[model samples]
Target: MSRRPQLTGRAAVLAVVVCAIAMSLAYPVREFIAQRRQIAELQQQQAKELDALRKLRDRGRQLQDPDYTMRQARERLFYCEPNQKCFVVMDRGKAPAARKPGRAPKPKAPWYESLWKSVELADHGVSR
Candidate 1:
């Protein structure tokens, strides 16, 4: 009787065949898994785009309504009806705040005075 644990010729051959098949299938199986993940990501992106499209369709519908346009104009453009009067009242109650005194910059000498000083220095140098 053969020992069950000992690898016979047929067992070894079968193990080798199984490993060969697995090796052959490895790249295709990995690619299949990667493609499935990519498909899932694309489906999620499509769902988001569909949701955005639905929102834009709803907005288009809202834009078609005259009341919505009127309301938008009243709020955004400050549009008044022909018979009605609207006034934009300014807050005149608050007076302009006076500025506090800050440090004054030192006054610089006029450009002609500096030029004359340079001329005097050059004349003295020539004289010496």
Candidate 2:
């Protein structure tokens, strides 16, 4: 008959000790992994915020420049130098038939008249 192997007391004790050590270390290892992931996410968020801050700072610096401010005013507000003629081109589809090409040029109003019209429009809460 073949003899069956039996577990020795020392071997059993060693196996139990190894299992206990692994169980003791598991929670701390999981917590360490989670904390590392959180730190990486926070760093990514911080980098994005820093990029946004840099863009805003650059815009602020541009705003501090008189030439940049003038350019913005000219583009956004349609501002022109004194004595310079400014014409606003309306969309062909939106313009009145009378304003089409080959029609008689409209009489020019005084500059103050147009300025006052803009002021009145602004006072009435018009956007532009």
- Which regions of candidate 1 are displaced past 4 Å? 1-7, 91-128
State TM-scores per candidate.
Answer: 0.64, 0.66
Candidate 2 residue pairs in backbone clash: none
Question: Which stretches of candidate 2 lie above 4 Å from their native place?
Answer: 1-5, 92-128
Model 2 quality (TM-score): 0.66
lDDT of 1 by residue, 14-39 (tens): 99999999999999999999999999
lDDT for each candidate structure: 0.91, 0.92
Model 1 superposed RMSD (Cα): 9.4
Name the candidate that leads on TM-score: 2
Residue-level lDDT tens digits of model 2 in 1-128: 97756887888999999999999999999999999999999999999999999999999999999999998888889999899898767685685556667878889999999999999999999967
Q: Which residue pairs of candidate 1 clash? A: none
